[model samples]
Target: MEPVVQFDHVTKNYGSQVAVDDLNLSIEAGKFVTLLGPSGCGKSTSLRMLGGFEMPTSGRILLSGKDVTRVPPNKRNVNIVFQDYALFPHMNVAKNIAFGLELKGLDNKSIHRRVSELLELVQLQDYANRLPNELSGGQRQRVALMRALAPDPDVLLLDEPLSALDAKLRQQMQIELKAIQEKTGKTFMFVTHDQEEALTMSDTIVVMNNGRIEQMGDPSTLYGRPGSVFVANFIGETNLLRSTVLGAEGNLTALDWNGITIKADQGGLSPKAGEHLYVVLRPESIHCSATEPTSGNRIKGKIRQRVFKGNHTSLAVEVGDGAVLNTLVHPGDVAQLAGDDIWVGWKPETATVIPDRHAHR
Candidate 1:
């Protein structure tokens, strides 16, 4: 019962720059795991190292308990689906999927059987004879995925594989990719900067920053209880308020933010009195009204702007100290709170507090 993939204190460097710094992670079998971060955050570097495409500067990478840190990409029981799809233009879907199996010296009958099965997996069975150019963007992507999965690697490494499709297609393929992974019961290590993609598809998400992991957990845990200021702002849209801890009572900490007393759960953090901290509130957490709701932390703010976002409206309310709190209110409520001097109220427990070590301001 060992981890299907493990990175033990792995580090990768490019000259003086550290791409992945002393990383340790364990990915179990048959789960969709995503390494998510912005550009140059070392997510791709880590994936490359795991695929044996790049060697780690230090530390070991084990595949199911066997050391494969310095092994070549071809020698490892892993296959990668690059962002470009990497399919041959001249080859049809079946041929592309059969390429790896043929290189492994499988007979014609075996290759055709495997190819047919894969084509059926993606529901592209009818398109097996169609060339890459003849297929849609989503179809071409499925071809690439089936090609990588055709080899039946111990783990499948996807390096932003859905990046090429349109927004709608991308969303559609996210569900498809996850479904395929679950159906095949293959261990998938996916890499992407798209937060929504990771949230929608991954069973676990590893948020990375500056070549280091910021946090790793299930989507709801990371979104609801971010460990750092960077993570709170990165995973989703949030209003971060600079505050000073006034007092602590068990799990709740009183804060003086913008001259208003707000109580937020320390979330296991033990902050001493007068410590500087940040309170993270999601847009949906802030309730907007024209009248004060005799509950929670009520603050007055001028309605600065309202954006129409389909189902709900996004409002920018300017509070005290020139601080603007963004809140997503239902479209019905926007009409009532349209004028100046709107009341914004949110329970203190709705906010998450983080240390100000990496606060950007």
Candidate 2:
């Protein structure tokens, strides 16, 4: 089967400032893919290029095996749900949802049937007569989705559509949106900087940085084994330590942090002797105790602060003059106190060591 969308060596530039740099990617049909990155990282730019709102400075965009590099937004079979919900205040929910159908010159009876189906799909059937202002944040978002899906486009693009809602509403909308997407079986390409959103909603995630794709894969693959330090740090909370690879045999890699020797996983990185490296260890993977650890790779430090989070405890320990390490302790195993000597330990296989020289660059 042909890919639903393909970007081949795509590049977009505004004068000398490149917004998308030599991007090559393909999306299968009916898959949920998200473009995630910080602000000004070109995530939104790439989405605009795909939507035909912005033309790529170079390369081509193919939709369902046809080149759409210069296709106008109206000519492409795609719809977008913007962050602002862009609803006409004078139009009620039903009118807003039917607007797109009317534009396509559909008959009144068919337009009514399609609008009804979309309203039910987004679970806003009861609120159809109400105006956008009468609905809640989540409801407004659903109305926006109904408007976008009313036309039954081949692809749907969401641009931070849930960012305006409160925490509870946002979470509710995430589940609702996922359910609607599954039921419709439409190809979706969402854009957001929220890592948690990308991780939770996407079949595949594309992490972008500085107008370039840093990594792309399934959520579990990106989280469990990151290809670079930027990905490890961006995806979740992690404790990074500067180190050097001493040796490697099989799955284990001997490492040295300054003068302390420890063992960690190679993390698919080929590090020569004396080469600088950084070990990424998730906060929850480290076990803490009042005394020095007798087993596993241990690091001694003084407790700087203890944060109680109800379900878990976060300990900030100062390991060196200005270096602090954070570890998450289970509520049941919360031990030690501030100003006390403590030990943090992690199994060799639990940590991933990658080259550090290029981390900040």
Candidate 3:
């Protein structure tokens, strides 16, 4: 299937500095694609370029295979829900939603029908006559979304639409927003720095850094098997161990991790003997116990700190070489390992070999 939106060799620059460097990406129709990265990582800039709010310095952008690089924001078949709910305070909910439909010259009857439907879609039918200030933050955000969807644009661009709400409201909106997208079947290009939001709502996540595409894949693929150290550290909690490659045989690569020889699955990474590698071990993958496990890779560490986090207890263990390995222990098992000395073990396949970013230096 062809992509609904395409960024072909796109680059955006501000004077001498580069904001987006040669970004090439494709967004399939009806898929919720998220641009996820930190501040100054160019996620918002890329989204702005697609929305025609900003122009590319050097490449063409296509919307449904049509070149729309120079198309103005108003001309493009897209609508944006800004981070701040940009609703007219004076206009009530109904008027706010009907604004775009009126601008498009739709008949009064049709506008009312569409507005009523949108109000119901966002569960705000009773809020039609109420002004923006009369509603809560989440309710106002829903109105903003209804306003954007008023015209039935081909793509909906969300720029951190849930960032303003509190934790509980933001979580609630995440579920609602995803359901709304599925119900409307519209292509969504969302931008966010929150990894959890991207992981929860996106069909495809494009992880960016320094204006470049670091990785792009489904949430599970990006989380379970990160392509780079930066991605591993950014997406979730994991232990990044600096190890030297002791040997490589078949799919298994042996590494000397702080005096212990542990094996890791290469996952297609070709590491030479004596070369340095960053081994990624997720905290959840490590099992801690009072006694040593009879099999698999085992290590002895001293538990420095234990944090009780409702569902599970997080233990910070100082294994060796001044490196602290984080392990998540179940609530039931936390009592037995309250002492300092503990045994941590994981399967060889649970550990993945990633390229050592510092190896080149």
Q: Determine which window of 10 residues in candidate 1 has minimal summed lDDT.
A: 352-361
Give candidate 3 regions above 4 Å deviation. Answer: none
Q: Highest lDDT: give the candidate number.
A: 3
TM-score of 3: 0.98
How many clashes in candidate 2? 0
Off by over 4 Å in 1: 358-361
Query: Candidate 2 or 3, higher lDDT?
Result: 3
Model 1, 223: alpha-carbon shift in Å? 0.6
User: In lDDT terms, how accurate is model 1?
Assistant: 0.91
What lDDT does candidate 3 reach at residue 108?
A: 100
Clashing pairs in 1: none
Model 2 residue pairs with clashes: none
**Model 2, runs deviating above 4 Å:** 291-294, 320-322, 335-339, 357-361
Model 2, 103-182: lDDT tens digits are 99999999999988888877778988999999988888989988988898878999989898888888878888888889
Backbone clashes for every candidate come to 0, 0, 0
Give each model a TM-score: 0.96, 0.94, 0.98
Ranking by lDDT: 3, 1, 2
